[model samples]
Target: MYWFLLLMAGVFESAFAIGLKLSDGFSKPVPSLLTAIAIALSMLMMSLAMRGIPVATAYAVWVGIGVAGSLTLSYLFLKEPINSMQLISVALILFGVLGLKVTSTG
Candidate 1:
């Protein structure tokens, strides 16, 4: 359950990141509000997950997920270019996250 929450937090973090891009530096009202909500929810879920997951592991996983998700979303929706090196880097981050999960006690 905590792992799931952590994943959700990471997903929300991605959402807020995309929202921020769409918000034009918070000039847009609706996207800005939504981004703020996502940020709050992401933090709350991450905090809850920390109760069961080690702080270091949880933080690393959360950041990995957020970074990977944001990069993928940007590539797909924003038409951003993705090189082989970027793909390899994202794969490495995913592997690190998986390693932490497998080694975690909770």
Candidate 2:
């Protein structure tokens, strides 16, 4: 359950990023409101996840998910280009997150 919350937090973080982009420096009211809500929800979910997960592991995993999710979403919807090197870097980050999950006590 905590892991699921962590995943949701990461997804929200991705949405926050996308929302921020769409918000245009908060000039667009609806997107700005969504960005604020996404960040709040992300933090809330991450805090919930920390109840059962080690802070270090949870944080790293959250960031990993956020980075990957944001990149994928940007590529698909925002037409952002991704390169091979960036993919390899993201892969390494994911492996590190996996290792942390495997080794963490909480």
Give me the runs in candidate 1 sitting further than 4 Å from their true place: none
User: TM per model?
Assistant: 0.97, 0.95
* Model 2 Cα shift for residue 50 (angstroms): 0.5
Clashing pairs in 1: none
Instruction: Give the Cα RMSD of candidate 1.
Output: 0.7
For model 2, how does the per-residue alpha-carbon lDDT over 30-71 read when each residue is reduced to its tens digit? 999999999999999999999999898999999999999899
How many clashes show up per model? 0, 0
- Per-residue lDDT over 12-105 for candidate 1, one digit per residue giving the tens place of the 0 to 100 score: 9998999899899999999999999999999999999999999999999999999999999989888889999999999999999999999999
lDDT of 2 at 20: 90
Worst 10 residues of 2 by lDDT: 97-106
